[model samples]
Target: MTTTPEILRYAAFTDLPTGGNPAGVVLDASGLDDAAMQRIAAEVDFAETAFVTGRDGDAYALRYFSPIAEVPFCGHATVATAVALAERSATGALRFATPVGPIEIVTTRGADGITAAFTSVDTDLAEFDAPTLERTLDLLGLDAGALSSVLPPRLAFAGNWHPVLVVDDARAFDGFAFDPAEARAFMDEQGWPATITVLHPIASADAGGPRRFEARNVFPVGRIAEDPATGSAAAAVGGYLRAIGAVVPPALVVIEQGRHVGRPGELVVEIPPSGGITVSGRAVPIPDDVG
Candidate 1:
């Protein structure tokens, strides 16, 4: 029996080829098992990869895998897969049934070319205890004063849980760094799945635009040092913003990530008037035969 090549490349969240997070896209994953999916992701070595199977009406059942394991959902990979499909079949809307819940995507073609935006599952936010916050800071090698009291420490989840730690200033964010081993150890002790450390400066005050934020994600449990672009994290931040009442209803925000490691990606999040958050971005193909 001949095995089918099951992976494709997509650069998520940017129009420029080099500006977004790269994800492995598997358009059809009928026979692939958990082990095979994990192996393919590891071979691609991108932050995340998406596998689509089981069509249900307008929505398709989707699963996400990292190099080491499977995750509930991944935003950048979703964006990448949607755009990849749209580029070939013409731009339109696509729906996904993820481990978390249903996600929606709309693809379009404009003068700048093709693009896509993904809507995440329903979100929730909850505050963390003082001890948890203190321990997390210690793990990251950050001082207590470095955090923003205004933002507070909260566990936000769109599909998966992420603890959002807001920084006092962008300069403090610049100095932010952590030993992955130490950080992983601390997270294990806390019993949290995975944690993403984010630092954000309010976007320029000029246009009253949606707040702009920068983020860094650590997925030690997934055996990755950092993620270039994260959609789940973006939804978590949206939930955090809404929980604090910092953002008004019908909010749209832009998240800039992946710059530190050179693969920069963007995520645009839309907070609905009723509920749930939508994350949108672009995904471009990576040549299949490239070695």
Candidate 2:
């Protein structure tokens, strides 16, 4: 008997139902096979959909799928799934066995709403060679001069890989254009990162406050111009900053994203001295009527 799994919708990185990235969450997907999950994701047509296939005690086996294919991990979907689970059960610590590895998540409820913070798998980073950087810039319709000297381009990984490009001028960063098909091909040729994150430094920590940035995460293959809130990309950014000696360990960075898409959202990143980065956000259930 083929039973239909219930699909829950949530917007991650923002408590507001209208803001943030929307994701589909299947709390009980044990009966669904990989093909069925992919079909469900395609039908949902969100940036990503998460399926909870198995559970033992507090730990759950998770799989992430985009509208097109399966992904190793997804941060926004993780937050949405965690918040969904917390609402059903209790708010506290939970473990997820993801394709990458085990991810630890802590859920807490405050006066406002439920919030979830997920610690990513071990993070790694590498600088882009000159030719590769040039090709990347060209594909994005960006020039070398637009690149920020403080935070150069690099490939960062925390569960999934992302190319972090810090732009010196916010205007140029916002205005650059590229063909989706071309960009997707280039990305596929260059290792298929989950997203290409372009950031503009809003405020520096040396200026007497927490380091802040505004970001636009591009994932052309997903058929979306920009992702509203990218938790995995934010985690990768933390790794990039730490590995490049841009931030002192044990720092908190605020990333403001999705403004360009008109669905503004925020992601908080915590960087420790070593290991994986932690990305925190709140997710709210998106009413079925909204979609």
Candidate 3:
């Protein structure tokens, strides 16, 4: 408790230090209390900071805190923490005891870097409420006509709840703009951390292609305006696609996020026939001077 904890910085979902979402990892948070953790997270000032409270055998108790408050779960932070742990320990399967549930993480080291895959908890998919949808459209300055015909709006949950919204126009999706304050209010009302907004440019609504999709995640609830890469949201989207029969079993989809903010990163999602969804991406240690 007397010693200063090392806040190692790592970028999740991308090998480049400048790309992907930056997360602060406190490998050992043994003596830190809730207030201390919150203060450290605020000082780090990333989208999310992960603290490893203790380790019981190979399982570690983990918690996520943002600048403002604590969140139930975080996708990118889990991957980053797993990679950080793998770098120090043996690179293999690891379990994390989160507030939501125990998350299984499998990490591997290669020439590219450390790659971590997280298996999500049980997923739930339902039509997103109409009132929330309307409020979101108004806040984003868009109408129902802007929505994609093939991909309907649905509320999806894996570790955290995220409303999946699909847009038709690529140009409009690329130029996404939303009021942060309005989004924060909406998120507070719904108790959601973020909304998954995506655009699939394929002319046909066909399945089985070069698995990739463009996405922008707005996370006002977590006190982050926008996230560069969101693994939980990506996992929810994968489950949503599967639930709607848009994708076949054993599918692999690459999610591209954080383009507008210039921190572009890719997250690979794998959907099994009938089980939990898996999200995979690489993480590289960020330098002390990196923004």
lDDT of 1 by residue, 212-290 (tens): 8888887663456777788888888888788887678688888888888778888888887656788877767766553
lDDT of 3 by residue, 147-224 (tens): 889889888888888888888787667666887877777777788864545555433325546467888888763446
**Alpha-carbon TM-score of each model against the true structure:** 0.92, 0.97, 0.94
Runs off by more than 4 Å, candidate 3 = 202-209, 221-223
- By summed lDDT, the worst window of 10 consecutive residues in model 2 runs over 218-227
> Which pairs of residues clash in candidate 1, taking residues 3 or more apart in a chain or in different chains?
117-280, 118-280
lDDT of the structure predicted as candidate 3 = 0.85
User: How much lDDT does each candidate structure score?
Assistant: 0.78, 0.91, 0.85
Q: Model 3 clash pairs?
A: none
Residue-wise lDDT of candidate 2 within 15-118, one digit each (tens)? Answer: 78889999999999999999999999998988999999998566899999998889999999999999999999999999999999899999999999999999
lDDT of residue 190 for candidate 3? 82
Candidate 3: RMSD to truth: 2.0
- Report the error of model 2 at residue 203, Å: 0.8
Worst 10 residues of 1 by lDDT: 282-291
- For model 1, the stretches where C-alpha displacement exceeds 4 angstroms are 188-194, 204-207, 221-223, 288-291
